[model samples]
Target: MGRNTRKRRTPLATKIVAGAAALAVGGGGLVWANFYASAHEDHGGHNRTRSAGAQVATIDCPDVGQKIRDVPDRARGEVDGELASMDSQITDAYQRLATTRRAQAGDARFVENSILGPLKERRKALIDRIQLEINRAGGKADDNLDELAGCQGRPADQQQDGDGQDGGGGQDDGQNGGGQDDGQNGDGQNQDDNGNGVAGPVADDFIDINDVQPNSRNSRNGLAADGDGGSTGTFSTDCGVNENNLFNSDNLIAAPGVDNGAHHTHDYVGNQDNDAFSSDEDLANADTSCQNQGDKSTYYWPVLRLQDGTQEFDANDQGGGAEGNIGKILKPAQAELKFVGSQQGDVVAMPKFLRIITGDAKSFTNGDANANTSWSCSGFEDRQVTDKYPLCPEGSQVLRTTNFQSCWDGQNIDSANHRDHMAFVQEDGSCPEGFQAVPQLQVRLAYDIPTPTVENGQVRNPYAVDSFPEQLHKPITDHNDFINVMDENLMNEVVDCINRGEDCQ
Candidate 1:
């Protein structure tokens, strides 16, 4: 891989100082904070502040999807379209902020007055349209949405996800470790390899694996307790590591029919016809990348890129460099997709087209309440770090592990926020009430990337996961998307293998 040769922009003013803030832990043990102010929120006027001698890092907007509990079936299409438009507005505003660093340094309120102000107005208009769509379909519009239209400017190096402590057990029994690297020099202004000065993946976002304490989860290994009927079998599916180079920025589940909805490219495997405009019938008939033709399920996640200067095919595209995600995309050395049974009881077959999204793509601004990223090194799999990218030693491959939700609500194939239909297993390895255990899909991707360097607070040739422009390419924002399209017989076979304590491929 070529070394990152892009000219890094140095902030003209004093470097940003870290901010002292607290995160409010939300559901699923995730952490969050109210970044928007209340008054004039209806008109998109929220309190935005920059710390003394600090720079505005990225835009922080309320997640409109999370706030909208329900959209009538007839209004779903229009509501989704408006949400996609809101994302585009944020991307446009961020692009302007990134390209106007010099102007921002010259004017104290340039970011607020020029970029954020107009961005909020646009968001408010879109949000109003969303309200109208829901009400027109005879569905109740959320009252809190008026306050969600406004976004604020967050200072650089503000802590969002991990606690200040160095090492600790994770929030679940499955994985007992999650923490972000807390190393910030705060000495120099630096731009990522993409040349986006304010958007991040700064030097502090990486940590050496040797520095992390061992915090792996205590797995039940699909074993059942006395009298407990647990499914103990395993099934493995062989899907190529996106060798076909299936790449796109569309999020079919979140913003269907909207091009470039993701604002970042994804590496796809499994179903061949997965994209923004793909319908259920299209996916069912699509060619399969999996070794088993019956397993046409679609699996995808954000592509990991080496910050080297080499421009890939999407270098000039909207979801690529144009949105601040630029680099040479790296193909995973190994992509392992496995299905394991529940520890508490037998697992049922996943409904076809059941969509599940793990982790929060906007964790940098929304906090880590829903963040489930587990990054480690090959030899250091037991030491997983959620918020920080690991600097694996020579000969050790970098690893990204994703453990999907194993419990399903059994009714709907999808939910409004794309999350209410599924739930993670409880600490005791049991499913929640009204949820049944399903074969949990675990994805592990290994990459052979050279360790990046942090010199005088400037990161050189770092490897970062693709992210939304305003998310700053934070590792905590890493996420995965899945659509179960397995044929009925194959899914039943998977359930049978798990329930019968047998291993099958």
Candidate 2:
């Protein structure tokens, strides 16, 4: 009954059915048209674009997987090279350490402590650097593998020991290299010329002569002798002249004389009584004791040659001709000890006759040869004089045998027992009141003191004599004594001698 009533169909319902049918046909036609078009076209261009896009996307994937695969090989090669270098450096450091130990053993107080600390540090650093490089490489490799395996999201196994823990074992190798750079030798010890481990400023065996500083008092411009008040003269000798004839002999005042008539001498007789001599008559009679005295009284009579090449006969300048004496009273020439030791004496004695000639310092001419006679008995009061002109007496004589000694054996003085007798003289102190101590430079320039021919050939400084081993056997000079007193430690005393002063044995 309901169907019969609805049979009279509604316009809306009919229209809905027609629309649905039309839509189905249109949809089917669109699908058919699409299928047909796809089937007909070759689609080669489209296929290329799609294929290229897919290839690019695949290529963009992370390279971590490949890098992980290579890490083990790279790490092994690098570690091998590093370990080889480390081995050499370690060997060097070990050797240096042994040397340092030996030196310290021989000398108890040797201090070379600065080396050990730096060496240890360097060794540690080298090991650390290697380990760090290894660990970094390993970590990169691990990270790449983990990412590729999709294991990156998982927490790392921190508990694993072999992964990187042992890799840093040689971290101190760098420290060893650094220590070597700081002068620690292969054995990690310092080297010195003395063969001692006590590292100090290096000593030089040879010093440049040009670099040597000149002694202040011995410089060229220092301590010049004054000769303006004296007269320049020459003298001649007469045969068989007695003391009276000797004193009264014309032009004899400045004539060179001899000690016991064997060795030539020079005397410094003053022109005025108060000046140096009492008077011309006194000068003429100065040899009264020897006038007519036997040959035993005669001293060596040497001729005096003046700068002008003139000669004198009597004290009054009475002799005439080229051989005649001049009126000037010849002053004593400054004497200097050119050589000090037996070896030096041998060297000097071979060339010269060892005669003491008197001449004016200013004129460079032979002075009164008789001056040696005056020096014979004179004693030197000043220690400086005794040290230098030990041949002189106090007052009466100009020279005495007691004042002179062979320089080779002259340095000995029992200071431990003879403290009062042996004393150092000051630089300003007098040698003798009349005589002066010549500076070393003056001795070299005037007397031509031999200099060291080779590097470190000899110790030429008078002060250096104190340091000489040979001098230990000789009498100590006043200068040496003074130096000993000032610096007692400089005395290398080896024997049980009284240290009245610093004694070097």
Candidate 3:
């Protein structure tokens, strides 16, 4: 979310900080031993050990966004700014790791002493500041926030095998795909990074859609299975697939007022005026791309790009090639936004300015607890994968689907973590005790991307979603954001149409 000039909160000052893991030497030996002992013990109590000489791939930090859930309204803006800064710190550190290969090889403690150590200290300072803000606002901060400041160096092939839990670069039962490869390109120019010597979207990241087993998912909404009862109706909105080329790297929800907070570009639809500085009133007064003038909501997600060495506009910019997100941006061929009723009963009208984020953008490191991925081919929509990128056969197109949380807390339009205010349906397909079901927003994005080639375990001309440099462009990190700005009359009309079991646009 970009903004014009204003005396705003401090922004992240770009500075290169080393990030990677290498053999501990000199002053880093004790720290490495401690890290090794703790990393094996602390990740959700799942003890998995890596070999002593296993290559440390990337920095794995505990996501503070999920913590500090009790921030007060008065302190939220400041805390959010600090959280955004933390992300930038990691990005800069990763840049150093990705670019300085010779330094890491020559000095055994280069990564630990120069990269991981400083990162921990900086994160600790930010965490302390968050605690102070919460306490000042009469909110109870999490007692163990200090413990989250430290991060571990994850191995390249590490997988979270035991317990099928999220957290730490574990492949949770196919939730985050298979083991990560060395992210080499078919051309074999750069061996460690992606084909472009940037971050990732390794050769193993993609799988043919035909190879995935069919019928792995059961119908959740009842309308798909022709079942009786439930609202069983739908309302579609005709927002173009960002044909106007509105793009940015700001996250208005998580990092409002911070530029390039997303560290990668996003494609926007519906609202024409959206950025980190967009207030509710600003959005209400802005123009919209929706055919219906009454609906001025905002919808956005990471943009997909083809890794064919094409330099887009942001090639030399902060959130583009400079940060390892290099390639030609791919426009979606189709973007469908639909509202559906719940399986249990009819849904009520959503309040205006309601915000919802459907997936986790940092799922690569933070785990799959918030991952909401749905990748498949146009013809093979029945077979969806959460982690692996789908390689559609000839004549078929790639598709990405997102189902927003339907159950609202009925109190707040937003939450501190941007997630607690909404909830997904339970196993029995009903809303929770104190929640009410609302129209679920299902977004389907289709792309007419050319199938990539793989030879000798290296991909060529691959397509991947833009992501945080440390996220490695993994598919599980895909996410979407929405803010409902529909007029009251239109909102009521949508609810009415759903209750009446009719489809309307």
Candidate 4:
């Protein structure tokens, strides 16, 4: 069943401690090693080696555990320095291992000397350091040795902070039956965290091109609406790598509060510090990582994976493969922000923290409802067609494009059901009757996932984001969500651009 769980958070004080196996799996030493015994002679007729090994219960070393639990303010810096260095080393080794594995998939001991051996010695020294700390804290160093040794040889991805899960956003393990999240997500008026009512009913009875003009697939990328019902102008912004502003997952649709992020994982970009516990004040006060010096909004969505059920993240086991687009994750190339449905004048400003969901996150991966998904060659739209996974032309990158509904009932920033506040625009780029029109937000992302094999010129391995919840393991899970965090200044810039009917890029 699709049960919602509140997000759990680790406090600031304890976050400084390094996780276990923070620096293992270097070089050829990653060959799985099972704990064994060097001495069999027992004076008491009972095996000390085997008995000691079974006591390994803690995930981290004993001293490190204490530091992790109660890191004092005065000694926090020293502990942080050690953990930061260890994490850096682990991350670097994992990247190199990934790269080398790409080329040396068959070479078993190729990296044995350079990376693994040194990491082994380094771990020994770290254990010694931990022992010293334990003695200073008046704890038993001898009793922790066996458990500490067992913590060695772990791969780097296990070193990730927090839960050590995928992207630190937590993975959704195919919660609902049939391994699908197709429960109308917002069905039963349960989509959102707020008490608001469900937005308008889900527009069932699927329509095609002639049936509806602008839909999940088309009529986006415009400047303003003309009297003749055509669209003109274009506006866009590129948001690059946002390493700071983030949250792995949150259940709250709009409000940023602690312990309420969704059970599944997501990647957040733009405004730094936009986590589960963040408030509107936290967002407004935070700086942005975008190039658009003025805008400070957070854009997020579920992460995508390749058909082979692999994504280039050091989530579960790091250093598995290296380089070569081994399932590289994708992000928006540009955010196409436009206002539609208005024949004249500027569009009204959207409420801050307004929530939006675009494309059916639960749509089947192929040729249905225009698939509500698009795949194309970079800078090439001619190859974009529904149900067909066409090959990209030489010198072009493959891309996916998606559109969000643009009409609002104007009474709420959100609804109980996740969809009511937003309505799809018409094929003519106009809002539907009775629903007020807002900016038509569109996002097109580029990906470098595994390409299909051509045996006798026939393409294979064609896939799409499969379904919701368990997105990392499926394709055709092409759904995305967003929250409006732009302050008044940037909001007005959007308003002015739409009002002048000039497409500003």
**In terms of lDDT, which candidate is strongest?**
3
Give a tens-digit lDDT track for model 1, residues 239-328: 899877777788888988888889998888999888888889989999999999999999999999886655556654567665667667
Error of 2 at 226 (Å): 6.6
Candidate 2 lDDT over residue span 1-505, tens digit each: 0000111222112222222232232111011111000010122334322111111100011112112222333454444343334333332332343234334333323322433334445544544554555576753323222232111000001111231211121111111112121222322232111121111111111122223223311211122222332111111112122212222221121111211111111221111111112233333323322212110111222222121211123211111111112222222232221111111101111101111222111010011111111111122212111111122212232221111111111232221112211221124322323222211111110111222122221111110011011011011111100001101221111111211111112
C-alpha local distance difference test of each model: 0.72, 0.20, 0.73, 0.40
lDDT of 4 at 125: 65
Of 1 and 4, the candidate ahead on lDDT is 1
**Tens-digit per-residue lDDT, 392-493, candidate 3:** 999998999888889999998999999999998887678888999999999999999999986665577888898887787888899999999999999999
Off by over 4 Å in 2: 1-100, 103-191, 194-206, 213-413, 417-420, 423-505
What are the TM-scores, per candidate, against the unseen true structure? 0.82, 0.17, 0.85, 0.49
Model 1 spans > 4 angstroms off: 1-54, 161-198, 216-228
The candidate, 3 or 4, that scores higher on lDDT is 3
| Model 3 per-residue lDDT at 294 | 90
* TM-score (C-alpha, index-matched) for candidate 3: 0.85
